[model samples]
Every structure is written in C-alpha cells, then in structure tokens.
Target: SQRVMETMAEDGTLPRNAVRIFWSSPGYSHCCFTSQNNLDPKLAAEIESAFLSVTDEDPIGKAVLEGEACRSFVPGTDIGWEMIEKAAEAEGLI
Candidate 1:
C-alpha cells in the first residue's frame, strides 16, 4: 500500500493536500486523510460523504478492497507534482 502511494506520488496522481493513506488488515477498509489547510470543513465533510457513498455502493467497496487503489479528483484543482513529491518525502515513502 505504501508502494502504491509512492507510485501515485511519483506519477502526479495524488490529490492536493493528501497527507496519508491507510490500509486495513482485512484489506478492504481504507481511509485517506488530507491536510485541512485552506479547506472548508463543510466541503471536506461533503467530500468524505461522497467517498463513503461510493464505497457503500454495490460492489464498489469490494472492488476498492480488492483493487489496487482508489482515487479522487476535484475538478479544476491543480495538484502539482511538487506537492506529491513533498508528501512522499514527508512520509518517507519516496
């Protein structure tokens, strides 16, 4: 899982302010925590709700549990590669 996060960071696919990716032992339950700076709490809640909705949808949770990775993108947001690299470095994942 750490390798996957590092790959995403290297590939510039990780979202802005993405702080951590956690994988559970059951191999299905996972959560991504992001930095709260410059973000609205309500919006963050909405995004988390959206993630949960998608995860709860039929077979999506199973897919996420079994699949390689789960991704989220905010339209019009530009998450530069530098941020990803920094995140990877901070986590010692690079």
Candidate 2:
C-alpha cells in the first residue's frame, strides 16, 4: 500500500514529499453490522451466513463485492482494533 502511494506521488497524482504513512493497522474492518439485541438468534445466524457466503464467483456476488471494494467476508473480530481506535482518537476522528 505504501508502495502504491509512492508510485502515485511519483506519477504526480499526489504531491511528492507530501505522502506519509503515519500508521497502519491491518485486519481491522472499517465497517460493521449490527442488529437489535432482541433479534432472533437463528435469524442472526442466517444473516451472518448470507454475508459470509458472498464470493466473486457468482455474478451478483461479484458485482456487490466490487461495488463495496471488498474481496470477501470473513468472521468478524476485534483484533488490531485498539491500534485503530488510538489512531482515530489521536486524529480526533472519533
């Protein structure tokens, strides 16, 4: 990712010497799904499964995934979230 940024800067899409990657915390999702706590467990499982089932092989799945800039969905986790939270707080984004 940093290489891509540097290449862009070289190509003049971004100002040279202006690009800096202060922080990066991979494996942390930028968005999430939530439902009411009262939602039925079975229905919740179904919803989760449906999301995880999407892949680039199916035409509709490919379109949806590409539109959202996502490759595929995996089980959610809070891993690496603390670093992201700290970075966001430092930037006053949260």
Query: Which number leads on lDDT?
Result: 2
Tell me the whole-model lDDT of each prediction, alpha carbons only: 0.59, 0.81
Candidate 1 on 10-81: residue-level lDDT in tens?
888985348675554543323435644679979977876765565524586657644635543222233445
| Residue 26's lDDT in candidate 1 | 45
Candidate 1 similarity to native, TM-score: 0.32
lDDT of 1 at 39: 97
- Tell me model 2's lDDT, rounded to 2 decimals: 0.81
lDDT of 1 at 33: 54
lDDT of 2 by residue, 1-94 (tens): 6766877888989887676888866644646776767999999899999999999999999998887667997777656568877998999977
Candidate 1: where is the Cα deviation over 4 Å? Answer: 1-31, 55-57, 68-94
lDDT of 1 at 51: 56
Cα deviation of 24 in candidate 1 (Å)?
A: 13
